[model samples]
Target: MGRLYQVTVVGFKGERVTVDLCNTEEQMSSMTVEQLKTKVVAKLKINTELSRISLIFADERLDDDSKLLKDYGVQHMSVVQLVLQVDGGRQL
Candidate 1:
């Protein structure tokens, strides 16, 4: 077992979820951004596509699915904001 990290995911309509993630640098680096988005959608019961979901931390938006969590500097007790991407390009 690896060290557990508490990640707070804030989504639309103020919906939030706290997820436990592995803190090992190697493990975190192996996980892709898409996997995290899927977990958030499943927890929030949101019927949204993975491509339309955006994860943000420290005011920086994570846009690459191929990037790892460690690449984004996600660590223990990190707060991530989840936003739904709309087609109109409107700011949320």
Candidate 2:
């Protein structure tokens, strides 16, 4: 894990999912928000086709699957809030 960084993904229940994102001294190599979501799902053993995963950073929802994480101001060592809506879009 050389030249990597940590982005702490904290769930609604205060659960944490650690993801070691690959990076360089400059910017990230086109890491998309969807990829991060995938890692979160795998780490937490959540759904494969997650229709309920949400990544919130700086009080803003990173809803675009095609967008990069850095485009949403998600820098290294950032704390992203993960909200998994259970029971059909309800936070349960």
TM-score of each model, paired residue for residue? 0.84, 0.82
Instruction: Single out the weakest 10-residue window by summed lDDT for candidate 2.
Output: 20-29
In lDDT terms, how accurate is model 1?
0.80
- Can you list the residue pairs that collide in candidate 1? none
In model 2, the Cα lDDT at residue 85 comes to: 72
Q: Which digits, one per residue and each the tens of the lDDT, describe model 1 over residues 1-92?
A: 67776679987778777976566757766877887887788888889689888899888888998888878987767899988888898645
RMSD of 1: 1.8
On TM-score, the candidate that comes out on top is 1
Residue 17 displacement (Å), model 1:
1.3
Off by over 4 Å in 2: 25-29
Superposing all C-alpha atoms, what RMSD in Å does each candidate have to the true structure? 1.8, 2.2
Q: Rate the local accuracy (lDDT) of all candidates.
A: 0.80, 0.80
The deviation in Å at residue 8 for candidate 2 is: 0.3
